[model samples]
Target: MPERVVPGRPDGLITLGAADALWVDLTAGSAVPTAFGAFTRSPARARAGYVLLGGRAVTTVRASGGRWSVSVGEVRRAAAELNAVGTDPQDLVRIGPFHGAPWQEADEETVLCWRRRIAGGLWEPGRPQRAARRDLDRPYHLAGIDWRQMLVERTRDGTQRTWWLPRAVVRLLDAAEHAEAQWLQASQTHQAGAAVTGPPSHPRRAARDAGGRQATDPEGPAASLRPYNGELKGQLYSVLSRKPGTSRGVAGWACAVCRTAPAAVLDHCHEHGYVRAPVCQSCNTLERPDHLYSNDIRVANRYTRLFHTDTDDWLRHWHRCPGCRARTTLPLPHLAAWTAHTACRSLRPTHRAPRGRTPCGVLRVSWTGSQNTPRSCLLTVTVDCCPSGEHRLLAQVPYREAVERFRVWLAETAPAVAAAAGPDRLDGLPTEPRPVVADTSGEGLALF
Candidate 1:
């Protein structure tokens, strides 16, 4: 047997920025699956939200069967309105399911449905069957000639059904329908543009930037023009045109890396060669070609490119935190301050160590790198003895490697140092969870 392919799951109400909806059989007093086509579409999942029905807010309830539930009495009056309608023989352009007798003398209670358009016109009704009163009272799912505007029920028994929506029900759901229509239209337009332009190009750097040359200086002004490279030009145009918060070509947006700086340049990951986000000139230079840096941006194992306009607010408000390893905390306001604070913390003995050990001979720890520099090319750890004031040079390594070396030294060598320092000194390493602020400016406090 051949494997069956399922269509991708549809976007939810949250992604669409609209109120969630659920299908309900008002007469039966229960909810039904909102989407059909178990074979054509992915498995359905229950969503939570309220919908306006019969002039009342009907809260959505997830049932044990992975469906929704509702009260019959709450929608009984509206059910009558939907059920009372019957087949109108006088109407020339009939579409969707209809109830009542197709001709005089036929049982009025029988259910009759018109087949979809065939040979440019709707076909005659199929064999009339005596339907349960509850089936007749089920509300019509709203639909459009060109776009699917309402719920479509596809049964596993190889049957499809949709009904005609009354004017009152349509009026109640006007906002949701309009929003869905706009989303569909935009998606179609995007697909058409992709067809014309060919597949989008992946992010790559200029030959000079990729060949081990240092990035442009941080103080220099960011490049305002779109990327000149042919491969990047098409993708840049598409991203700028679709990215939200960007109006008049990047004027309305701020850089994602540095919240305070204007978004003057597009930043892409050096390792993966894909656009990450818009960033300021300084941040762009700070990102290394191999992603080796002591900054917060390097913490994420993977970075996401903003593709949806609706996700602009989320990107602006959330960021990955290097201190706590939390991916959604607010960004550190001062990168330099956070780096210095983290370096100091790495030198201290962790609280996991046993208490009552003698103080370590290592009194003061200092590094050689300047705080203002974007990259710490090398880190030099030196310790100064207290009374003798003798300075001793220790290991020198890359900044990130130095941090780990300090952790290992403190764990293994610090206890031996306490014995060498003799019993005269009583000061012990501080083990409190409270972080020492790097400066008086009160920056980088969110890490704690």
Candidate 2:
């Protein structure tokens, strides 16, 4: 064994350093789990090995205002040591930067090629040095190895998308925060549900205070164990225990995406245990802003067709998250997937050209229970509104289109109202909505 000495800190947990072992304690918000009740030391070590060797850490969790604050600073020390490249063969792995590799420069290729290549995503054909950024998209979870991942990509269709996430995401996420985000993401997956890698026998929530309970504790009650956070535990059961997103006992209010309230987020820590955060259901449960395949590693190209084999394909994904390196399955179908549904749901993520006056009178109204139907109307009426909280709404009212349609329909169906209407009354209303592609294929079916 490599010098089994604990660099002792106040936290009693010793870190075995390169030179020698020293007794040192950690600071208040140290990333190292002191005594996490949810996991065995063996798995944790394997995980830790993978993380430490990465040369980075999630310094900021999503809830921590997306800031990377918690690091042992060992990363800097590690960098300095590894910066020399070929220092000590025993402690250092040669991360041969593939300054020259035959990577795809085409806009059409995706990371899936690495899945079928002779070198695999990790290795080179002839004593490959370190892998290139365009080299990996699969979940290469082993520690102490050189791995490459892409953070963005340009699709062949002349559209650009991000497969890898931002670096700010790192150093910002600790294990628990990352785990919760992943857990919340796994729940909202579409046709090919997301997968959880290296599941603990009975994963439990992280304990916040001394009063928090632990099932794994020798003296604690294990039979009736529940998640550490009470509200989230209740909500997780409500949304996940039964069919996903269905109306269950908890009103699916806990279903972060569907419910209007910021829902509880779930994850695990190295030493602390599972962590659940109170976040917008949409951000937490619906479209995973965190789950992405970057420009270099085109994950979408890989899984578009991986499940035709006799083997249980869905159960065998190996793509690791660039954020926490948490192993995850295919991108979950968002509760509001399908281009039309997605666009209708979040105007923030959607981009549409301004509507122009069209021959067909179209009224795209997003209505809520509180609002009554217009006293009189005409033309084409389309509404893609879903019900939510009583009032506290964050929706975008179709400012221009709705107004134009109202007036046009009034002119045809209720000309009296059109004549009575004043320009001041519809100041924000445009003269017309731009003509859209006759193709409704990209749009959502009209919803109530």
Model 1 residue runs over 4 Å out of place are 1-252, 258-260, 282-448
* Stretch of 10 with least lDDT, candidate 2: 316-325
Best by TM-score: 2
lDDT of 2 by residue, 1-448 (tens): 4333235422222232311111112211222112121111221221221122222211111112321111234433333422333221111111112233322211111111211231344444575333345524433321122123222332323432212222221211111222333332332442132135433321222223443322111111111122223343212322344565332222222322222232323321111111223332122312221122210011121121222221121111111111111211111121111111222333322223358421111113222221112222111213322222122223343323344433353345434433443434433322432221111221111110
| Residue 224 error, candidate 2, Å | 13
Task: Give Cα-based local distance difference scores for all models.
Answer: 0.29, 0.24
